[model samples]
Target: MRRGDEFAAAIRRGNRAGRPTLVAHLQVREDVAEPPLVGFVVSRAVGGAVVRNRVKRRLRHLMRDRLHRLPRGSLLVVRANPPAASARSEHLAAELDVALDRLLRRRGPDHQARTDGRV
Candidate 1:
């Protein structure tokens, strides 16, 4: 997930859900091993270096606690929107939950998420 191509592949092939604070993209790959990989995207639109890092830190912490909720071998990219720079950690966590739920709901019980980027 550190590579640009990895993020691009997930963004291109994953299902996404957008919230006021952030947007999350999830791509499930059977080829990958257990322990899903995660990446973060905080653009200048959100804020300066200090603010962006703060947002990324908070998001990383939240995602760490929730990583087990995601399917194995999935690639998740959480992109912070402008509002996320000022949003509370709790608010961000809530938005992440809602977004993940919406994304997961699109997949059937088989845990194979859709890649069409819809819903």
Candidate 2:
């Protein structure tokens, strides 16, 4: 998820959804045979280093709570919008919930029919 190619692949090939605070890209890989991978993108356009890192931290915390819901071998990239730099954690969490719900619900049975525990 840290690699540029990983990020690019997810962004280019995955399903995408956006909210006021953030945008999410998700790519499900049936061949990975690994757990879900998640990455964050907090650009300078969102804020300076301090703000960006804070936003990343908040996103990490938020995603951690829902990581278990993703299908195994999925790749998810979360990109913070400028609004995320100053938004409250509660607001960020709400936006993230909606984003995850939208993305996960759209993954389809082909992606969700694995033996793994996924929704």
Candidate 3:
């Protein structure tokens, strides 16, 4: 999941949800047996190397609690927006929660149906 290809695939094929501070792309992979894979993208638009690393650290910490909530084998890429550079951790966490909620709800019914082995 650390590779650029993985991030590109998620961005291209996954469902997306966004907030002012962050954007998330998620794709469910049926063949994966491992826990959810999460990646962070903090562009230069967000800040310098120090700032980007800080943002990434904050995101990673926030996502730890949320990993279990994601579908198993899901690929998730969270990109920090420019606004995120000045955003507080709480604000980032709130936005992440909202985005994840929306994304999960959008896929919920279909996922449940598939897991139940029904069309």
lDDT of each: 0.85, 0.88, 0.86
The local lDDT score (0 to 100) that residue 61 gets in candidate 1 is 95
What is the C-alpha lDDT profile of model 3 across 15-115, one tens digit per residue? Answer: 99999999999987777766778999999999999999999999999998887778777889999999999999899999999998888888867575442
lDDT of 1 by residue, 40-94 (tens): 9999999999999999999999988887777777889999999998888889999
lDDT, candidate 1, equals 0.85
Residue lDDT tens for model 2, 42-116 = 999998999999999999999888888787888899999999998999999999989887887797766555524
Better of 1 and 2 by TM-score: 2
Indicate the TM-score of model 1.
0.90
C-alpha positional error of residue 112 in candidate 2 after TM-score superposition, expressed in Å: 4.9
Q: Name the top lDDT candidate.
A: 2
- Candidate with top TM-score is 2
Which runs of model 3 end up more than 4 angstroms from their true locations?
A: 110-119
